[model samples]
Target: MSYIKAGTDVNGNDVKLHYIDQGQGSPIVLIHGWPATYEMWEYQLAELPKHGHRVIAYTRRGFGNSSKTWEGNDYDTLADDLNAVLETLDLQDVTLVGFSMGGGEVARYMSRYNGARVSKVAFVSAVTPFLLKTDDNPDGADKSVFDDMVDGIRKDRFDFLQSFGKKFFGVGVISHPVSQATLDWMQSICQLASPRATEQCVYAFAATDFRQDLATLKVPTLVIHGSSDDTVPAKVSGERMTQYVSHAQFVEYSGAPHGLFVTEKERLNRDILAFAAGGTVEGTADRY
Candidate 1:
């Protein structure tokens, strides 16, 4: 990683985009989810470069070291902000990857904007197709659950985020190999995020229906899910997304939780590289 060059968006409001540019092949733009910064993909930057692919991961507004925005925080605005970042950098022949809420960002882009610069798409533990249960989506979580989440945010966002962090790992109260230091680091990152923006994002995640948007995607897409993900279950969210995405490949990680990116980074990274490098590989859950 080198000193990040600053860039401005269409709003002329300095949108702090930090990047680690390496390798000399097609670019891979990584979009992270709620309460996480570009640092989440730190595991990828060093490796992907050695593999001959450019990896660009940046902090979205109101997260990490990026400029905090209290203005509008919605999916459309978030998508436009990303578009600005991509356009300003003049990135082409790119592979867009998104995880969790980041997946919502990817789906929104594919649906609204013409993917002129993007060649491939990957969704790792993405929330898409639909997250809220309605007349059409009986499988989704009840609307009240989202409403309760919003209420929790309203009461005490900091504690809410802290508690949410535990559920994010889905390991429950039991212990894991990942040290307390690592867990604290992740929690600190989530805690640093602006509560106002993060709360709005919760609504964005719960309310927005990406089914229609996903149906419009023609680009080669990979949908990766963990079987034991409690935050956003594989069957309801990811599995449903595949039905909408034309020609999308599905991969399931057995007993892998939502934090598969962190818990199973090596295998996830390998899968991503193989798919992007024009190599044939299986998409099912197999221990690396």
Candidate 2:
């Protein structure tokens, strides 16, 4: 891994983004979910490269070692920050992967920058299309959920994460319970983020609509979600998002929780590798 650093312009206002570059060949950029730093994708960072793909995973603006400012935590700026990293590195034929909140960055990237120089896109248990329920979006998540999230954090961040972390991995799910170690590690990462970023992003992810972006994405896409995902249920997010994509391959892990990356790491990695390699899947987009 190269030395960790942030990019800055003439004014030094700070385009603070930190990422790890590894391996050789086609690039795969992994954007982490909410309340998680680059460390969350440790498995992908370590395993994907062994298959000969250059992997890049980064902490979003306020997570990990990146600068944490009071404002500009919105999705548009987040997407711009991601694009800056890609453009600075002059990456091409890249496979952009977004998980959970990070998925917003992917959608915004394609919508805002027209996915400049991107090859493929993927979402893992992401929040997209539209998360918060509204007049037209009847199946969406409730605004109260997001409000409660901000409430929880403002009330007591560390305690809130301890419980939020449990819901994230579906601790009591009988089929596949996430290990306690993973849950604790997840909380650690979540707590590492700027509390302000964590609080503000709740409003961003819940309110932002990506239906337009998803419809216009002119790249092969992968939509992976867990059937039992409690946070961003597949029915509202991944399942519904397929309708917007022109050419998409949807994979729903049966009874899998939202954090399938940890619960079902190996299978998820293979699916991602296959998607990046242009491998075929039996099911079609319309099937979802």
Candidate 3:
């Protein structure tokens, strides 16, 4: 087990990012989502190396070790933070692995800037194109839902994360009957994030529209989603996301939920490695 190394974002804030660097060959950067940290990728860190890939997972600003700033909670700032991390480490030819909200950041950054540094991309249970249901996005969660969520965050960020965490899992119960350990770990990691920062990020995600961003993804892309996901339903966000990305492949896991990257880590890692290895991937794997 490796310890997280400390670092800072482009803004030069005292941001701490936990990372597990393993193996050597191609570099793969794993970006996690809200209410979760780099620790969410523990299973992938341990397994991806055997496939001849260097896997890196880090907590985003306002989550886990990274510094929590009241400012820069929007997607553009988040993308700049990622750029700073990659550039600071002098990493190149990277395969960006983004899960949930992390997917939004990746797509936004790739849309704005594309170079040899980013080779390919992957989205696991992501929120893209757009999350909030506007007049145009009628199928998405209503704006009121996001408003209520933000309201809950303002009322009490901790409890808000706890309740939000429940929605992240398929079985919408607070007790977490399916995977209590994962749930507990998620809560603990979230506790490390700045409550104010998390709350601000909620606004950023709920408002930002990534449809144009997805249209700009020109590199090889992999879109993975859980068929049964309630948070970001496959039929709604993930499916539509694939349609927008020019060179994207879609993979749907039936019966899987939003937390497949956790519950189904092994299978997720397998598919990611195979795709990163330049092989064709089409079909579902085991559900964790």
Q: What's the TM-score of every candidate structure?
A: 0.90, 0.94, 0.89
Q: On residues 1-288, what C-alpha lDDT tens digit does candidate 1 reach at each position?
A: 332323454476666655556677888889987878888786877687778787888777777777677764678877876787678778997889999989988888877787768888999999897898999888988988988988998898777877776777765657463556667878788777787777778888888998888888888788899988888899898777667875788888877888787887788889889878756447653221
Model 2 vs. true fold: TM: 0.94
RMSD of each: 3.3, 2.2, 3.8
The whole-model lDDT of each prediction reads 0.78, 0.85, 0.78
Model 3 C-alpha RMSD vs. true structure (Å) is 3.8
Cα lDDT of candidate 3 equals: 0.78
Clashing pairs in 3: 16-65
Best by lDDT: 2
* TM-score between model 1 and native: 0.90
lDDT of 2 by residue, 124-205 (tens): 9999888989998999878888898899899999999998888788876554387778888888878878989999999999
Candidate 2 weakest ten by summed lDDT: 1-10
Question: Which candidate should be chosen as best, given TM-score against the real structure?
Answer: 2
Candidate 3 per-residue lDDT, tens place, 3-67, comes to: 33334446775655556677898999999988678887878888898878877877777777766
Q: List clashing residue pairs in candidate 1.
A: none
